[model samples]
Target chain A: MSEHHEKPEISPAARRFIIALCVLAAVLVALEFIIHRHAYFTTEGQPLFFAVYGFIAFIVVVAGGVGLRKLVMRDIDYYDQGERDE
Target chain B: MSSLVTLLQIPGLLLVFGAAVVPFLPHKLRQAYMLAIIALSAYWCWGIDVGTHLSTNLAGLDLTLVRAEAITRPFALVFHIAAALNVIYAMHEKSRLTATSGLAYAGAAIAALFAGDFITLFIYWELTAFTSVFLILVSGTPRSFAAAMRYLLMQVSSGVILLAGAVLLWHGGQGLSIQAMQANTLAGGLVLLAFGIKAAFPFLNGWLQDAYPEASVTGTVMLSAFTTKLAIYMLALCFAGTEILIYIGAVMTLFPVFFAVIENDLRRVLAFSLNNQLGFMVVGVGIGTELALNGTVAHAFAHIIYKALLFMSMGAVLYRTGTAKASELGGLWKKMPLTMIFCIIGAVSISSFPLFSGFVTKSLTIGSVAKDGYFVIWMILIFASAGVLEHSGIKIPYFAFFGHDRKFEVKEAPLNMLIAMGIAAGLCIVIGVAPHLLYGLLPYDVKYDVWEAGHVLGEMQLLIFAILAFVFLMVRGWYPPEIDSTVLNTDWFLRRALPRTVNALSRPFLAAWASAVAQSKTAILAVLHTGEETSRKSGLVSGVASTGAAAAIFLAIFALLLLLRFVA
Candidate 1:
């Protein structure tokens, strides 16, 4: 069905990035287990937390905006030819 | 305003009657008539009293035209908005019956929220069921007809259960004063069960997925707002703190995500996600604290916008492209940029992105659960939230808007369609950006700040991480994308597997019955033919033999009866 569409190739850099993410996730999970085992994390007020929150929010908004513009869009009638009830 | 509340009582019916006349009118007048009904209904909504009684009965049932209280206000406000917006969205459709039904459905739902008595609620409650069915029928497809029947049956059954409960409560001399449901009694259970059916509680969930997808694009938009939310509203008001709802809510949240993951129809996926979101409000209602109740009400308020926005986006797609199957769709964002943007906002909001509408409203429920120290429920809720992101967040957008861009061309959504979405999308953001606008309307004061550093960071971390997981799975081809195929969940018990099983189990029985019917017909025909042949061949002989036998039997019976009577 997608004969005219070329399959995009995956890059090594993207693969490396994914591997790094996996490693970071593992470290985070390990940290969570350790902290829970010792019960080290507490809901205490911290300025650094707020800063990080704001920063991440900024990053996400920008990233999501760009991604929507670049990757996620379509013509209104793009799939008009597909199955539809008259 | 108290006097004005009475207008809400009957205006919906009046508007419906007025809308019924639209078809006979000139083409230009149809939209005007529909718009007038909506305008009048909105005017009536503004006049209805909140937190006060409008009418009461000798049986001590307090019938209020409006309860501007924190709990009911959000529902009424959102419903009014949705009704008006649906009118706008549906303006271009030629079906006058649909407009009339929409008016009646919205009016009934709006009145139901204001009902201080079970009787009044029951009246409007059934109105919602009866009138809303027109929407599906207006679709004019065989599938929609069947779906509408199922939807009507389910909704009518809910009304029956609710009415039965009301009757029991009234007769038992309790004097119906709408309050929380009790666990030990038949009446309370029936009422709770009624709400459960409408609320799409785990097992009773199939009707929504079955029906909503089959509705007209605009019909589904209206469908998204009222029925389930009203159930939640009832649950919040009447069954608050029923501990079972906590577990039920947990299950409701977690289970649908998996089905949503593999589901092909974007609308059905949204329907599942809707069920998941309702679970949060259910949990809050079960918690039954001021904060929790506030959470439930607030969540309902926020959810209406975002969910409608989501539906609006998909509806636009379906309206223009005519199919909502994820696999069959790709890359229409170029033509429908506004729709894409709006849908993404809806997605982020549903995913509870920090600073989005869902973030503020949903956290209250999550926070309340955490505060209550129900660690397991909270954990399940978080899991469900992640699952929500997976199905609705990545799946809906990735397939419908972005995926492979199948290179088909269609015009952007109609101007009215864009306007409808634009309004709903704006609300999603506005409510998120300034939650106090919504939070202030909560039944109880919520002291917790949604934008607090901890809450914001925690939610951001969770949602962002979930998105990362989705992207990772997708990029690695680990994400399941069985688009254009249904991935049944508990609905399987009804929609496919149960129906299939029933059909399978009945095949032999039906065949046997059919064969028996055929055999009986043959035997009767054979007997008739034989009798005709006998009459033709031996009519005199047969009559003489019959007469002789009849005379002999009459003589024997007469002799026995006469002997018995004489002996007595």
Candidate 2:
């Protein structure tokens, strides 16, 4: 079975939601500089460290999942194959 | 929290036997009765005070029937709370077997929390397994049957290992008490391995993902609360400061996030999320500070509630729509708005949003890690935090409620389910808003300010940006589409490779056995041939008078043999 290639429908409400998310992200990014962040490690003190790390980590995790599917995903009945259904 | 060591009989064990009669009661009466039993048990746990030795000698071994650590009180209290909640959550179900077993399972776990010695612990260890397997079996599907067997095997294996560890402790001249021990020792390692399997440490976690999702909806809700948390409680007691667990836990937190992202079953996604949540607790155990231990206990308490809420919401979805696969579920928010809200609350709580249970409780563990200066681990945990948002915090709600609307025409979840979720959601908020309620129950004082400006801002930034990435992926069609497929985990070892390997290895022996059977068949056939051939030697039976000739031949051979013997 092929992966569903259906693109999500973005309505006016969804667009507004995305815009709000973007604004929230922008505000958080702005606050990273304004908020005197306590840094345990030296690199943690860098500008926009958390935002960059979080955004990239989320992408990596999702993208990594795509690659993982190729290696591990089996037919839904993989475990049931050849066994009589109880 | 009490360091009370007394051999007084605790009353939690009675709930197990009390459940035996649960099946006989009328449904409404049974619910009320079990709740009363649980309330009574909670009262028992609340009444016990600390610091006296009271172990009875059984067969020359001091069996500690009653024990309490500083951490024990909260665990015992929450377990009773969960027992009561389970009764309410399953109130609408008619299956007497589920109620009876679920209540018994909770009882066994609570009893275990008070066990001062390893022997007592082992009994309850297997008791929890034996009771909980019924929940999985109640699902009544072939898939669930197979999963139940595997789940039982892993669980029983853990108990057997616990027993063996206890025996080893005795042989080494150490008493069979459940005290902190060095993991490098054989007995300690065996005990830790036992706890690790139940704790769902990395590779051993397959059963959690395999079985929990396969349970009956109410069964899943009940199953979510007890078994694994019991394991975590044991791990914290036995293996705090064990360095390997820190690394094991970090991998545990990281790997599941990726699997959860591609997992199509919403319930299975939550199971994976449970594994990840356990990792934070595990890291706290490994850190072994007062703060870390407190974190572990607090996290378990909050985790049980929110995790059960998450499972219950999905349970509602499964009950109403008859499916939990994300590929088939969407737009449920339209029909089940309240359930959707509860699910989102669960999602946000698990995601550690600043004003939820996970935020306050989970911070202690992360703070402990940061304070301990395990930089790489701290980083992995942070990344995994974002990953939590990806799967649980976002994917569960987004796919089940808001994603490409599947237009399910189902009604809202049952009244009982909503009530269960509402109470749990309220607890999450109460604990989050006034952290001290839970803090006061901790084994040690919670000095970490969860509401600190810096910590809250950083957590918000992490979550907010992760949301941005999700939006980015969705707009670009870059997100992996949910497809219903078997996502392989360590269980593949038992279900596939182990069986296949055994069959392959037995081929030569099977062939030898078949050949030996064929050789034996030939020998038997040869012996039968002589008896069947009466006229093989024509001279013996000879000419015309066949019956007389045969009789004369037999007499002549007998006479000749007698003569030959006489001559010899």
Docking class of 2: medium
TM-score for the second chain in candidate 1?
0.87
lDDT of 2 by residue, B1-568 (tens): 2422122145467688788899999988999999998988888788776543356888898898887888888998888878887888889999999999998899899889888899999999999999999999999988899999999999999999999999999999998988899999989989999999999998899999999999999999899988889989999888889888899989989999999998999999999999999999999999999998999999999999999999989999999999999999988899999999999999999999988999999999999999999999999999999999999899999888988889888899999889999999999899888889999999898898887777788888888888888888888778888888999999998888888888889989999999999999999998777555744544334435777867888999999999999999
User: What lDDT score goes with residue B506 in model 2?
Assistant: 95
Which candidate gets the maximum DockQ versus the true structure? 2
Quick one: best lDDT, which candidate?
A: 2
Candidate 1 residue lDDT tens string, B1-568? 8544445355354454555576677656777776777677667655655456455554455554444444665677788788888878887777777777787788788778777767777888888998899888888987788779988888989989988998898788775667765855888888898999999999899888888888888888888999999999999888888898999999898767766765678998899889999889899999988888888888998898889989989999998898898878988888788889889999998988877888888888988888887877876777677777777776787788877677868988888888888898888889888888988778777798776654555555456556555544455454443434434445446544566677789999999999999999999999998888767634743666876877888999999999999999
Each prediction's TM-score against the native?
0.79, 0.94
Off by over 4 Å in 1: A1-86, B1-18, B21-40, B56-69, B489-492, B495-568
Which candidate number would show the highest TM-score if scored against the true structure? Answer: 2
